[model samples]
Structures are given as C-alpha cells and as structure tokens.
Target: MYFVDTLETEGLGNRSYLAGGPGGAVAVDPPRDIDRVIAAAARRGVPIAYVAETHVHNDYVTGGLELARLTGAHYLVPADAAVSYRRVLVHDGDEFDVDPVNGLGLHAVATPGHTPHHTSYVLTERGRPLAAFTGGSLLIGTVGRPDLVEPRLTEELARAQHRSARRLVEQLPDETAVLPTHGFGSFCSVGRVGTDATTTIGAERHRNDALVKDVDRFVADLLAALSDIPAYYAHMGPVNSAGPRPLDLTPPEPADAEELARRLAAGEWVVDLRARTAFAAGHLAGSFNFEGKGRLATYLAWLIPWGKPVTLLAASPEQVAAAQRELARVGIDRPAAAATGRPEDWLRPGDHLRAFPRATFADLAAVWRTGARPVVLDVRRSAERAAGRIEGSLHVPVHQLHGRTAELPEGSEVWVHCATGMRAAIAASLLDAAGHRVVAVDDDFAVAAAAGLPVDTSDEAG
Candidate 1:
C-alpha cells in the first residue's frame, strides 16, 4: 500500500491522507486543499473511491465533502454523525477494498468518543492490517478530549472512547502503524506539545498515558485538562458543512485617510496592524487596533465579523500581503483596502490619542522599590504559562481578554507578557484602548518573579 499524509499548519496541525492500491485511492481527514489530494491520486494512476472524515472537527474546517464532489468519490462519515452533509454513513464492521492499480484493502473501525461519529481505518497490504488511521480518537502521546462537544456528554463519550481504543489494541496487530489525524501543535491531540504524527500500535499501547489500564483514571485525567474552544469554531462548522469556500487573493489598493473615512462611514472596519507605540503615536482616529500581534487570525476572526470589508494598516507592503494571506487562511479574506501612510502620519497632532507613559522592565523594577507595584498581566495560554510565568502575574489568555475585561485591574498600571514580546504588545495596546495605563513586558519571566511580584492562576483564564 502507498500512503501519503499532507500536513496543514495554519490553525491546528491537521493531517490529511491519500492511500492507494489496486481497488483505487481514498482520502482520509481531507484538508481544505482538496485539489492537492486529488492531484496526488491522479499521479498515482488511481481513481479516488472515498473521501472520509474521522469526526466533525471543531478547530478548523474539514474538506471531506469537497474532495468527494471534486473526485466523484463517496464521501464517508461515521453512521452516528450529527452534522449535515451529503455522505455515506459507514457503520462498525464495514470494510472496503482499494485497488488503485492492483492490490490493497482498507477496513473501517468505529471509534467514538472524540465525537459520536469518529472512525479509524485499518490499511492492509495483502491480508494483514499494516496500519491504522486513527482520527481524533487517538494521538501518539494523548487521547482525544471528550468535552469539546458537550460537557454533559463527557462521561458517555469517555466510556465510548475507552472501548474504541481497547478495540484497536485487541483487533489490530502490534506492528500496525498508528497514523493519527493530529500531532504536535494540534489542540485536539492529547498533550501534543511535542510529538510525532505517527506511532506504532504497540508503541502507543505501551507509551500513551491515556491507554493505562485504569479507564476511570484515564477518563478523569483527560476531562480535567480540557480547554475552551477557539472563538471561530462555531462559524467554521456551518461554513465547512456546506462546502469549502475559496479564499480571496486580490486585496484592494492602498487607501488615503479620506477614502478610509468614507469606507468606515459605510460600516467597514479599518484595522490597525501596527506596534502599540506606533499606533498610540498616530493611528487613524477611529480604527480598531488589532495590531496583528497576538493570535492574529484567531482573534480577528472571532472579534471581527466575517464579510465585513476591512482596511489594513500594515507596517510594510510585505506585511500587508502577509496579513491578508493569514486572514484568508481562516476564511476572513474580504478586505477592501490597505493603508500606505507612515504610522505617525495617521495621527498628525490633534487626531492623536493621549499617549500614556508605559514602564519598561527596568522602570517596573525601579517602581517596585518605590512601592508603586504594577499588576502584571500574563496574556498567554495555560500550556505556555506552565513552562514558566512571572511570579506575581494575573493570567488572561489574549483571546478571552476582550470579554473578560472586568477581571483586570481598573485604573491601575498593567504590564502584559506572553511567551514572547508579540502578544504582550497586542494585549497592552488593547488595555490602553480600554482606558487603562499599560506596558508590554520583555520575555524574562524570572526577572519579575525575582523582584517579588504576585502571581496566581485562574480557571476562568482561557
């Protein structure tokens, strides 16, 4: 059997596959780039027979139905799936043979837990199962979290998942390769911080933490670390359910202040993707300051409504193009114009907002000595925070800060930091825009901790 997996790094690290044999080729966990999978099959001289999705994904759009339409292949989904789509509902014990050119067979195994309709495929070269394509149900080091769908259904989902994993262990040979749809960097993966895309069934059985014999302990531990879904997840389900939408490549030309004003008057968003200092010095008076410094694509899609025309204020022509591409990756491609003016030109004296003085790490340290201790706000995720965070910091994942503004200190000096300088800048600027004195901290967490700051973690923080 010939197998190929395409890796998409945009939102989550989603893996798509193409498997071929004498029966024909089949695609599994299809990505938005349906053409790539189709072209690969054509090169292998095989007609595609199936386009399959292991489960309904919540992190990014799935491209199974699109591939089916393009290749005239059967679109396959688990028999229990709830989402609306034209698909062949395959049940447990279902099997299919693939003859891309000559000899191969693939068997589908029902693996529910990640979602009610999740399934894994067993690839056979001759008569033996050589590999298993576990969708979100299993990863190299982690098992899929069962809480993404509904909190109330977690127990049922976990029970189902435990059974599914055990079935794979009992039915498939120890040598069978375990090829999962997600790996390191995918939120759907079990502790995917640093792991591989594929692992052997025997290896997973021995090494995967979730595969421990104690089913109750494994399920409880998995449920304990669940995270809130990204804000754009809800929109993606409807859009992807219909079909993959093509992204826009042509961005409108540069706009002057007058043109931008007229566009905004018509209810378009003039997004400023500049440094906090630069934007504070002189941005167009009413532009929404996103700064493109945090989870740019994630927050932009969540906070700004799609299909709303946007004018971008980028640092350079290259940045404008890059920003447009990133926005399109998440389906926010309807940009009307991009600004070409220097950062300061947008302000021109009276148009400028009062630039609040911000303290640097040095300034913050100096203030600590004088009793003016600022509230350190660490705007990073739970995983990043685990590595090391400033000692006296309030955790607020940047994506949720806009809605949870009340939790932050009012009228107090706020210092924000992330794993690096970028997200901190975005958070600091947002705080300033929301009428608070703010500063962007450097990457050294120990520096603040050593200086005797307060730090506490909150479950409310995303």
Candidate 2:
C-alpha cells in the first residue's frame, strides 16, 4: 500500500507532496523549510529516495536541493532549467524506480506551460498510475499562469499550457490523482481555483479551463484574467534556478526599545506581528502591522522595499519565530532584529503607543450620515475593483500602496478596505505609519452593499 501526505504552506498558497509505498518516498516541490519535509518522512518511517522539482518555482524558494542533499536522494529537476548545482536532469518520458521491490516509480512528463522547462511527475505502483504531481501546469480548476517567466513568451507559454494540460488528461488514467503545487492560493494560479482538498483527472476534465476551452479561447481568457503578481516573485525563480541557500530559522537578535525606535526612525521596516485587532488598538508609532496570523510572507515581501532590513515586534517569541519562517519561504531569510511583548515593551521611554480605529462598513455608513467625507481607499486588486467597488473610492492595491501612498489624497482620513479585513489592517498600518489618520474597515466586502454604501458594479470603478 502507498500513501501520499501533503505539506501545505498556506502563507504562500502552495503544496508539497510526500508519496511512497513500503520502499521509500519521494518529496515533490518541497518548500525552503526542509525540517517539515524531514519530519514528515520520519513519521512515515521511510527515507526519502528522491526530491523532485516540476520547474524552477516563481513563488517560493524550493527546498528540493537541500532536502535531497540531506537525505542523499536523487534531486530531479527539469533538464532545460539552467541551474548552477548538480541535479538529475529529468527529461520527457524519463522513468525512475522509486521502490523497485514494490514496483513503484516516477515518470516525468514534460508539461512546459508554467515554464519552458516545467514537467509533471507521475507516481506509479506496479506500472499503474496512482497520482500525477502537476507542478504549475495542471491545477484543480485552472492552469498555472504562463507570464511569470518572460513577458514576450507569455502567449506562447499559454498555448503550451493548454497542450500540456491536454497531454496529462490524454496520457494519464481518469482516476489519476491530480496533485498540483501552485493552485491552492498561490499567486502562481491564473483563474478561479477550486477550494476542494482533492481532485482527480476525471473531475478536472469537465471543469478546468484548459480542458474546457479550446487553446485560442483558453489563452485569451487566461491573458485577460491575469492580475498583478507579488513583487517578491521576481526573485523566487532565479533563486530556485541558481539553487536556494540553506534556510535559517534562528531567532533574530533581540532589539532593545531604543534600537527599535532608531530603526523605525531610520525608515527601516519595524513590523508588528500581532493580531489585527490588537495592532489597531495599540502599537509602537511608525511600526507597520502584518498580522502574525495572516499572509505575512506574501504581503510583507510584496510591499517592503527589496533588501530593506526588517525588525519584527510581536507579542511573543513564538509569533516572531512563526513570522520568520513564513518570511524565509519567500527569501526574506534573516530578520535584522526582533522583539517580543506588548507594544509598550517595544516603546522607548517617554514615547506613547499609537492607535487607529477599526470600523465596519456600517460604521462607515454612520459616519457618512453625519456628512463626513473621508477618502475611502479600496486596496483590493484591480480585477476585484473592476467587478464591484464603492463609488468615488481611491483604488490602490495593497502591494503597490507603500510606493503609491503619495497618490492617496492628503489631509483626509483614509478609510481603507479589502476583500477581507486582513489586508485592510496592513494598509491601515501603512497609512498610520505614514502620519495619516486611518480607519480600518474590519468587515467583509460582501457586507458593503447591505450596509447602505454606494457600490458601483461595473467594469469601471473610480
């Protein structure tokens, strides 16, 4: 009997797989933190025989190289990917015995759409296909985005993605498990992805865009729906291709109150990783809040100036460590400093804690009843804004907010909101740190219309 265990990095919206029978296991698209993969193998009571990469990932650093080195496993990477390190260059239709005793093996199928070198791996037991690890090519409901590699090759890649998805459906059994690495919530996905935990080739055949639409339609729709990618993604592909450095999860140096203040004053990122509510209630002045419970890596790495020294202030050491791990996955390997305790603990002597109000759309409506005209800043993506948005609101996606803060109207209290409140809180913190009075709309965007706000449901939203 064989087993497949999933290792999900929810912050980055990707999944890695560990699958094997009695002989050994193979880890597919592992993250930078190899300890979890190691622990999973330990629990399975199997030495990992191989670490496979579907392609050079553009979302997070791959742990494949280190995981393979540590386990003495064959590191499988696409043959065409230009990498500095040594690896088993996997080619189309290449087969490797994962468990010769049980007749378990992996078959590489070149599925070049997510990247020119992207490949999908099929896990077979006794020459019968059991699962297909379709890295960025064949996802649950949508295919991986093709524009990540190079803008000039986007349309060509999109056409390639269609062919690749069809190839998987044609070559694999209908029941072959479609295990993908990018669609869970990763920006690597292009269209509306399914929320189901598991899906098979048969299920995806009826619904997946690549399978449902012809190549021309699929490519057109994919290019149309493509949204802004995380700024940090620009670094991930090169890091993976060149071979990611070993991950370091060591707690950063302790930052005294004065040092924290000095760093903040120097315009360094002093991130407060507390619950959004706690952060809104009180935080050290000039400290930005990226809730420890939220997508810290995705947002922080997307917004912060690349290579800026970061200092973390959290309510506890565990929170700091957790944030550090999340950041490390996206290549923010080392935090300059960290502090734990209440906001007051990180405040310098004679300095007071800063606060911003968190209100719902109802409160926003109530404020408008009194004729208050605060600048409502919609920080959702442009695609989301185009679907529906509060009329007259200024739009700036959260990732672009740091550099575009000047575009927001000055001398007005900015009321910031996103699909949910987490991003709004991040934006609120940014506005607060920039010396603007802000209110975080801690409510779902779904409630905005019912709250009597003027919502414009059209292609154009100001």
Candidate 3:
C-alpha cells in the first residue's frame, strides 16, 4: 500500500518525493525549504522516518540534513559523498526496513553518472519492487547531463550514465515508477526531446534516448547536448558539501525610492518581478525583469552574479514576499531590499521609469505580410530554437546576447522573443541598454506559429 506524493520545484523543474505506508514515510531530495515537507508529513499523519539524498545537488541546496535533524529522521546519503556533516552513509544494495505496519522497505542502487557519488533508491513492499527514485541518473525524457561534475570527467560520466541506465531497467520491473530529480525544465537534461514529465522503467526502455542508444552514440549525443551551466552553479557543490544554512524566509527590508536608486547606483541588482506588460509600461531604468509569474527563481538565479546583493521591485509587499519564497528554494535566502509601487513615484530628478513597446506575434507577422522589414531577435536556447523559431530571427541565446550585441543588424526595429515573453523582456532591456531600438515580443511562441509567421527548424535556422 505504498503511495508516493510529488513536490515540484516549478522554477528549477525538479521534483522531490515522499513515500509512505501505514507504518511511516520518507522524503527524497527535499528542497531547502523544509516547512512544506513537514506539513506534508503532518497531513499524511505519518512520521518521516528518513530523509534521503540521491546525490549532492549542484543546482540548488537541499533540506535533507536539516529536515532529518529537525524531525529526528535518519539522514541517508551516499557513502562517498563529500559532506563534512553527519549522515547515514549508504552503499550499493543496502536495505532498510520500515516500521511493522508499513510493509515497505528501501534498497540502495548505485547509479552514478550524474555525479560520481550518485545513488538511486528503490522502494519495495514485502520484497516486491514498487518504484525507483532515480534522481538525476535517468530522467523523464532524458538522462542527467554528465558534464556538470567536472570538465575532464564529462565523457567518462556520460559513458557511465549509459551503463547506469542499462543496469537500472534490467534489474527493475518494467512497471516500477521512475522518479527523477532533473530534466523537467531544468538545464540538467542531456539529449532530452520528449515532453513526458514522469515515466516508468518500461517506458524508458522503449523510448528514452539513454536506454535506446548504443554507448558510443549515447555518449556523443550527451556531450553534444551540454548547455552552458548557469554561472551560479559553481558555488552549489561546495555549499552542499559543507552544508547550506537552514533556510530563512524573512521578508527583505523595505526600501524607499531614493534608497533603491542608491543601491542601483552602487551596482546592486534591482530585479522587477512584475509581468512583462507592467514592467515594460513602467519600471526602474536599470532594473532587470524576470516576471515573478514565470520561472523567476531559475532565470534570476542564473543571471545574477553569485552572492550579489539583490533588491526586488514589485507592485506590492505580497509580490515581494512571493518572490522571496521562490528565490529561497535555490538558497537565495535573503533579498537585500525590496520596494513596492509604480516606478514613477520613486523617479529621481534626472531618472525616469523606462518604457519599452511590446508587440504580439501578429504584429510581427503583419510586418512580414507587408513590405516592411523587422529585425527579430530570438533569445531562446538552441534546443528551443530548434523546436521552432522565426525563419530569419537573430539567434543569440539570452545569456549570450549581452556580448553579441554587435553582430545584430543596426537599422530595423530589433524585436526580441523567447519561448514565452519572460526571456524576451530581459533581452529587450539588454538590447535597449546596448543602444538598440527594441520591441519585446510579449506573447506566447505559439502565437507566432499560429499567425503564420515565417518559422524554421534548427537546420533551417542556422
């Protein structure tokens, strides 16, 4: 009677899980914020007996150690993990039996490749396998990118990932649940092409690129699919090894318009969490917009320099508090300051709320329908661009745009767009800052396709 509950970290595209039966339960790969996990346990009326780590996370800090400490649950970590703190060191095939009522147990399966110390945990009820917490080893539509560990180890790890995926499916039942930590929307996927967010061992055996390809092809494709690791990723491993500070969800200090401007003058990031429409119509001149409704945590965490002081620009205290919650999941525990209200109210004598025009896909398509020329800037990732893009859009990934501004054409209105408008707003600001007349395509990517705009695939795009 084992059942699994999912906890999605939306911005990171990661999933943690809780498994329980009548006897008790365990949490796997909980996020830095432990309150929710505590609440989940309380709701289920089960004491969490263990908090397990599939690996030392490199994208966000984990709450495993702290959760276990707070709840008095056993902390299970890989035997070779670099943690200086204490944990129940587990090895291949190690088994743990839960309380008598649960009729459930856990079996460790060594499945390295995402990292050297990665391990998967299998849930079994009365010796029958039910599910495997594959973590970053084998993901939904892809396997975890092996290159995040170290430069020299990339190919070796990819090969190991091949072997690991093979062993997992071979040993586990086809119907066994395949739960993973990466590849949902996170940048940690390697050669991910499908849309399924969760899959069974049988499904992976049938279609997963990692399981279906030969070792050489798999390794080649995996290496080819590596994306630029977020600049902030370097700090994650060491922090996890030493131990992350227990999360603090305190709201940031309120900043007046003048103080916020001063902070911006001093080079602090003033991120606007409002929607693209609101941000474009009015925002602090130098502020970056990730749009709090979108993947605020991932993009903001990716773009902002590590340990940089950040002050949020929002329309209300509630928005500021909401943004804080998302940022904290990635271990950005404290925002230096936050200010609410329209930017114009805080505008200094010489300063003004920057306003940029936004266009829908239809507007751009109409331009093409007419004889008018427009410079479309596609700031999506290579994979996303390949999925579909405007035939002639300038293909600079948003992260790479700041440096490649020179390559863009000069005359026509530079229109920026990503899969959704969120990335586009960020790029529009960069282009504007770089002295280009820009229009943010503040609408869904489907709009462009639906409007019968000129679109191309990866081959045609390049």
Candidate 4:
C-alpha cells in the first residue's frame, strides 16, 4: 500500500511530504532542517530514494540538496532553474522510479505560475496517477501568489497560474489527491484559503477561482488581493539559487548578565523569548519581546535589521533552542548569544526590570470614559485595517513601526493593538524600547465594536 506522510512547519505555515510504498520513498520540498526528514523516513522503514523541489522556493531555504547528499538519493530540480550546484534537471514528462518493487514513481508536470520554473510532480503506481504534489501552484482553496517574482512578470504569472490549475484538473482523475507545499498560513498563498486538511482535484474544480472564473477575472481578482510579502523573502531566492550552506543548529555562546547588559548598551538586539504576559510583567529594559510561543520567526526576521547580531533571553534553554530552529528556516542562521533564566538573572548590577500595562478593549473604553485621551496606535496590516478600524487612531503596520516611531506624538502614552494580542505585545515592546509609554491591548479586534469603540468601515479608514 502507498503511504503519503506530511511534515508541517506550523510556524511558517508550509508542509513537506514523504511518499512511496514498501520499496523506498521520495521527499518533496523538505525544509532546511533535514534531520526531521531523516528521522521520518526511518520511522516508515524505508530509505529515501529521491528528493525533489517543485521550484526555487521564495519563502524558506530548501533541504533537498543536503538531504539527497546524506541519503545518497538523486536530487531533482526544475530544468530551467539556474542553480550553482549540480542536480538531476527535471523536465516536463520526465519519470523516475521511486519504488520499483511496487511500481511507484514520480512524473514531472510543468506548472509555471508560482515561479517561472515551477513544476508539479505526480506520484504514480503501476502507470496510474495516485497523487499530485502541486507545490505553490494549486492549493486547497486558492492558488499560490504569483507576485513574489519580478513585478513585471506578476500579471503574466497570474495567467500562467490559472492555466496550470486548469491543467491539473483536466489531466488528473477525480480521486487523485492534491498535496500542496504552500497556503496553510504562508504568505505565498493568495485569495481566501480553506481550513480543510485534505482535498482532491474533483473538489477543487468546483470551488477554486482559477477553475471557476475565466482567466481574465481570476488574474484580476488575484492581483488585487495580494498583500505585502515578508521582508525576509528578498533574500530567500538568492540563497536557494546559489545553494544554502548546511544548517548549523549548535547553540551559540552563552551570555551572562554583564554581556547581555553590554550588548543592550551597544545598541545590539537582545530578544526576550517568553510568554507575552510574562514579558509584559517584567523584562530587562531595552529588550524586545517576540513571544517564543507566537510567530517568532516571521515577526523577528521581518523587523530586525538583516545581519544584526541578536542575543536571546529565554526562560529556559529549550525555548532558546526552539527559537533558534525557527529562525534558521528564514535564514537568521544563528543567535549571536543566548541567556536562559528570569529577568533578574539577565539584568546587570543596578539594573531593574521594565514593565508596561496590558489592557483589553473594555479597559480602553473605561479609560476614554475618564476623559483621558491617549494615542491609539493600530499596528495591523493595511488589508486588515481596511476591513474595520477604531476611529481617530493612527495606523502603522508593526513591520514599519521601528522607523516611523517619530511620527507619533512626542511625550504621549501610546495604546497599541492588532487583530490579536501577540502583535500588540510586539508593537508595545518596540514603543517601550524607544522610550514611549505604551499599553498593549490584549484582546481580539472583533471585541472593539462590542466594547462601544467607534469603528470606521469606510474605504478611507485604511
């Protein structure tokens, strides 16, 4: 029997797959951390015979090269992708045997929309199609975003995406399973996505925009809904093209209270990876809170200056280690230094912990009733702000808030909020470190209207 195992990187919202029958298996779009893939293949009682890439990924570094090297498996990459290293150049209609005993193999299908050289692989058994590994081409509900490449190619790529999705549906059987690498929560997805864990070609044909709408309508709507790509994405393509070095997961040098203090004084980044509530309760002054429990990689990589030395302070060594793995996927390879303990342990002599208040929308309303007017800062993205926003609030996306702090009123206490509390805490820390008194609204945005706050829904609110 054929088995397809999914490996999910929840922090980045992407999935990789290992599929085959009894003879051996093939790895698809593996992450930078190749050990996990190695362990998974071991658990399945099969050697990995091949490692394949659907395209030169624009979101995270791929583990294909390293995984193939270690396992002695053939590495398959799109023929047209310009890469420095040697690989098995996969072309359309090419086939490779994954498990000769069970007649399991892979068939390459060119699906150029997510990237110019993007290709989808079909897992076949005995010359019959069983599964389609549609990486960044056809997703569960919506297709992958086409704007990650050059701006001039975006519209052209969108049209290509429509054709690619239609091609999969036309060529595959209704029962053929559709497995995609992007769109769980990754920024690579476009349009409204589904929450379903599994889908098939037949189901997608009825609901996917590319299959339902004409190519012109599908391309138009997709181009309009595209949001800001993460700042770290600009480096991903180049790193993957030239070839990413082997991952270095070894912990960095340890930092004591003195070193932490000196780094903070020297204007280096000392990130605190604790629960947001624990961070808000107390942390070393000037340290930024990224919340190890939240989207640590996405936000940390997005805001920190590229190539800056970062020092990590966490409650335990385990948290620091976990954050290190997440950061490495986005190309923040290693922490300059790390400390494990409480704020008291990280603080220098004569240094005290700093704190800020965390309030809900109800608390915000109570403050307004007392006739105290503080600067309400909405730090959600532009797309979210367009849906609804609190009246009379200044807007700044959290990613851009570091450079735009001067735009806020001087000497005024700022009230910060996002759709949820995680981003609010991040923004609160940024403002706090910048010497501004801040309050983080730890509540859902939906509660704003119910809390009697004036929410503007007009187009101009964004």
State the C-alpha lDDT per candidate.
Answer: 0.70, 0.92, 0.85, 0.94
Candidate 1 residue-pair clash tally: 15
Report the lDDT tens digits of candidate 3 across residue range 221-296: 8887787787667777888899888888878888887888898789888888888888888777777787888888
Worst 10 residues of 1 by lDDT: 453-462
lDDT string for model 1 (87-147, tens) is: 8888887877666345577788988888877899887776688778898876777777776
Candidate 4 structure quality by residue, lDDT tens digits, 411-460: 99899999999999999999999999999999999999899888999998
In model 1, the Cα lDDT at residue 64 comes to 77
- Residue 125 lDDT, candidate 4, scale 0-100: 92
Clashing pairs in 2: none
- Per-residue lDDT for 136 in model 1? 80
Indicate whether candidate 1 or candidate 3 has the larger lDDT. Answer: 3
Q: Model 3: clashing residue pairs? A: none
TM-scores across all candidates?
0.81, 0.99, 0.92, 0.99
Q: Which scores higher on TM-score, 1 or 3?
A: 3
C-alpha RMSD for every candidate:
4.2, 0.9, 2.4, 0.8
Residue 208, model 4: Cα distance from true site in angstroms: 0.7
Going through the candidates in the order shown, the clash numbers are 15, 0, 0, 0
**Order of the predicted models by TM-score, top scorer first:** 4, 2, 3, 1
